[model samples]
Target: MKHILNTLIIGSLIAATASSCTAKFEDINSEPYRPGDLSADDYALGSAMNNLAGCVVSSDVNTAQFTDCLMGGPLGGYFADSNANWKATISFFNATDDWTRVFLKSDKVLPVLFSNLSVVEVVSQNTSNPVPLAIAQIIKVAAMHRVADTYGPIPYSKIGADGSITTPYDSEEMVYNKFFEELNSAIAVLNEHPNDRLTATADYIYQGDIQKWIRFANSLKLRLAMRIVNAAPDKAREMAEAAVDPQFGGVIEQNADNAAWTYFSGSVNNPLFVAKEYNHEGSKTGGDTHVAADIIAYMNGYDDPRREKYFVKSEWTGIDYVGMRRSAKVPELKTIGRKYSGINLSPNSPLYWMNAAEVSFLRAEAEAVYGFNMGGEAKTFYENGIRLSFEQWQADGVDEYLAKETKKSISYVDPNEGINSYDKELTNITVKWDESATPEQKQERIIIQKWIANWLLGNEAWADYRRTGYPHLLPATEEGNKSGGVVDSNRGARRMPYPVAEYNDNAENIEYAVNTYLGGRDDMSRDLWWAKKK
Candidate 1:
């Protein structure tokens, strides 16, 4: 929440070096004053690129816990916090500025991205190849879009411009349009330099694979296109069509082409693994996050083969893959919730940026709903998404799994406390694609599978839930509805309130963003620009 200008000033100082020596002294002290004096190609641009990659999904443990595990994961119905102390936070529909501010903090997404982007730009200027700058642009969109999605309007397109402390907020529509433009420009540049490996050592996602970067940029464009469909249908169709047209470049279609940030053995551990399985005592069980009941119910009912891949079995008596329901009392949560299944990630696992399965599902929706040419029919893309997810997890029985037309999400049973249990099936949606199904049902099918495939990428899942109302996530319990009637218990929290620091520092812009751009009060209950009511 610190002013972007302050962060930019600090970053610029760190990036620049002082050369105080006169011409005569320079001849004697021929060595450059700092690393910045090195040739642009010799500068540590890879480190800047790697940091940008880490910021995409956040490799830091605490940041991951705050932004992903405690907020997006539960809100998206993927995982719930097992630590009872956090029950009053966003997981319970309550917006705590202390916790929510971490997403926008100078150390988190925005400042780090803008700073590193500046470094990339300055370093890449002397080089003729545009791949580094283009990749940085793609990374900028990848990282900042999450920030924009978290809060409706964000200080984008003008963060470091003119170096003003009171940065203006861009409307959600404006932010998304800028994202499209950045992706288009980056993809064009990368396409021109198809074999450029200028960013290989610095690139953690694809090791400077320009083709993969182009594919990811296109895939990202497709995602944003779908995100804005409800708000701007014509533009959404135009961008989505352009994304998969193959003339510019193809979208992510194979598992090998998936975009992810890998964890170097000694440098940084996977943050999700640390947040979910590593504790202060260096043990796994007491970590804060556990699989949420919604995912468990859906997977259990389907008899999903990937359960073993997704979660470790619960240590509690008579429970296999039981999940902790949201909003359990502190006493029950601390005592029993700790025994629920934790996420099955390891410290060395790669944090995914985007995957082929998600892209396939996007194509499936575009084809089914918008009648776009996604290189195949809806069923083909839908089935391919399932197959790709299974393959990604190394799970078996995909052939049999796709044939499942009868299984649906089963009822959630809390063996320890019936108060947390749901008696009815979560949803009646099935696995196999049905040609005669209504448009809504088809969309549900595609999104449900997409949600399952998008495990741990909770922000995207949350966005999809808000946009399409798919997977029919279980509503937060009465105890979890802590928004004082502002947020609907059934609908859940829509967007995080603007950072409290913005109110204290940039009061005028915050007011303008709320009144003019948000078109509603600055609260968690209001729907974002892309959010459609079910």
Candidate 2:
């Protein structure tokens, strides 16, 4: 009895100490720390930046690609629950921000940025400190863009809570417009602050290089402009043209200077690589999130050299796990002579992005929308975009493996052939020679090629799909699934909504905001104001 009592007392004391420590320690809190507390010019901003970047494809962009990523499979992999590859777990169907759920209290970077801005403004009142402030607001804009872009309509200019109760969702149009204004504003600020004292350590991106930030700002402007292509074409052209301004700097001209985030350098690991390839034989999160049949068919049909790099046959055993992307019954490797085309799942694989190919493609689309069938020029841009995409993924040997262009060109194909054929429930879209296609059809072919160019980066692809409606996708044959739901293998949901937790907790404000803008913000298929009407 005495010994037991002693053990109980010791346990209680230990528990009390741990409790006290947790209470005082900062990590336990759901709220972010006040930015004012930081006294250094060098502040940590990588965590917030990573989340903003990760939320795009690694989060839900793959499943929600709606059009681009599913080039191989038949029943677009988006609908099938049997998408037993590593990606399905990373992306799943209806959840874009689930991985971000646990870190929900508040994004840590916002307050830090606001605090930095406060200091910058106070320090340089009379002088125009446009450059540093521009960079700062950029961080703000990037973070907010992810939030707003992911969840259709969201709180923007009205973000701060003057100790107020809740925030409301802003109109999608208003939000997009504000994004334009903010980028311009940031540019002005960058122009104002030419001080050399500014350091790059704070920005994980470009390391505080104002010039690069300017280029990124312009690039961001181009991206946002494209978002509004359907609603306002002239406006889109105007903004895109403005980005090409030599004065503002512009998107990466070369791959060397491209804005990118690397994971291996720090404790941070590439989320995609970790979940799919490098970690636990792709089984940790779950293996081989079967590449959609549509995606498989498209690549195979083109004799796309990229096919090998992007996917591996189950018969090939570099990585263990379930079938390939097609949900195919992977045959015996030795018997079939099928080999696993290894994915560059290196922990060292580039986790961060801002690829040059994106800029080139953005330019191509910009030209296309602006009536630039301007001969081979537009096609060259399109081709360059494809080349860059292939090169990046190490799939450029397409000339060797894929069919060369013939007098009569083929376009799209049915991926239901031989080893390409997966399970019964799936269907794929492959590129075949369509000699009957006219020059315009050839243009559609060009767009389709660009479509495949967008692989891991699906948000941009989704945006492009919204703009052009290319590659022909059928709606997921589901009843309850209004958009990209469990049955939504064909079409992606229009937008992710605010978390149910946010809606329920702040019911009144959320309600007012939804009713004010689009009827029910929860409806994924209901388009954002700036998005095309189709």
Candidate 3:
């Protein structure tokens, strides 16, 4: 009994000693330093900028490659599948999910951009420095607008309101109007600090140049304003005027001022260049990317100097620029892959969100459509746009190319049998600014050239084509539209379907949006408010 009692006393003493040591060292479990204490500019601004750039320019499958390269590239008629691979993407069949990925928060870029912007906005709440906050807001609008354009109604104003996980959506129209308001607020903030440094070190597009940000903002405004011309002409004219109004700021007027983000050197090369032609076996075999017949024929017909830069000479057809038709499902695609022209594969190339050439074309369209004071006639702006595009790409013979009016787009002739051939003479459309052409003809001329200048910026090009129905994109008849009767594959996809997660997580809001904004259904057949046919 004495021995047992002694053991109990020893155990008790050890327990007490252990408790003391644990209490003494407990503080070590906490963080050495809190990251939350950092200022928005110190962290949030940089995070927002990088995240935004990544979402728009990254080569990851879920981001830029899927949304821009795979979908936008082919749909915009800038490229075609040389190997006839990725049929689901090329044919618009089984493509709904890829389209919806642009808006979904499931590891996609849009949600990351929004989250970073929110952080920036919160951090700037107590500061007199509005530059960081303004830049965040501007990028918010720039990035979200693409999302809004992808699917008709999206979570915009109510994204994180009321601390709710399931956010309600704003109508496409409401989202567009909100974009204008956001731009106005951001511009005002920027104007207040004319000399203040932007987050240049963090910014990939402008390197914190406040003036360039202002220019990009105005250029973005102009682009958005033009999008609403058909659906909301009065509002379009008003907003467009506001964009170019001297009081706000000037638009991007030179190639140097274009909103572009270059790839990081070495390991972080351009994703498109890597994914399309250099990443894996597909890339090693030259991948499926080739110049679209639609675009190549037009360029070849006009003797466009950009052709050499845009594509490699065909090895099979023995032609300098052989292209494949978009959405062509032929056995020949499997055999004659090397015969087609290859796309530009520079790993260091910059991804353009908007360019001076595109902005000039927007101004031309504005002057032609609304008679806005663009400081030049529509014809002058039109010609300037062409020259800027040539200079932007470092192409020669701008004068000679512009001088020819009679050279029409040649019909695409497939060298392989069993492949469908189109000989529509795309060049029947001329480059010469015909002063006496009908208003419709003039609009076509402007939009087609604008499309040419647009080149690789697939989302913008696709959006513009949806809005104007210009350049007369050929209809794709291959199946895979899951919308049943909702999407007319012939009219082309109007918008991507709302993500399935919305139906699961935010069912009530999704239902209401479909009923009110989407005519009782969520399908690609339904046009966004701005893209509706007039």
TM agreement with the true structure for every prediction = 0.91, 0.68, 0.86
Model 2 lowest lDDT segment of ten = 20-29
TM-score of 2: 0.68
- lDDT by residue (68-90, candidate 1, tens digit) is 88888988988876655554688
Give stretches of model 1 more than 4 Å off. 1-40, 161-165, 278-286, 328-334
lDDT of 2 by residue, 93-204 (tens): 3334443221122323233333334433332332333444556566566555655655567756765521122566677777877888888888766755534434332344
Better of 1 and 3 by lDDT: 1
**Model 3 residue 370 distance off true place after TM-score fit, in angstroms:** 3.2
Which structure among the candidates has the greatest TM-score?
A: 1
lDDT of 1 at 329: 38
**Each model's lDDT:** 0.78, 0.47, 0.69
Clash counts per candidate, in order, are 0, 46, 5
The residue ranges of model 2 lying beyond 4 angstroms of the native Cα positions read 1-39, 43-130, 161-165, 191-200, 277-290, 316-343, 372-376, 398-403, 406-443, 473-489
RMSD of 3: 10.7
Which of 1 and 2 is the better model by TM-score? 1
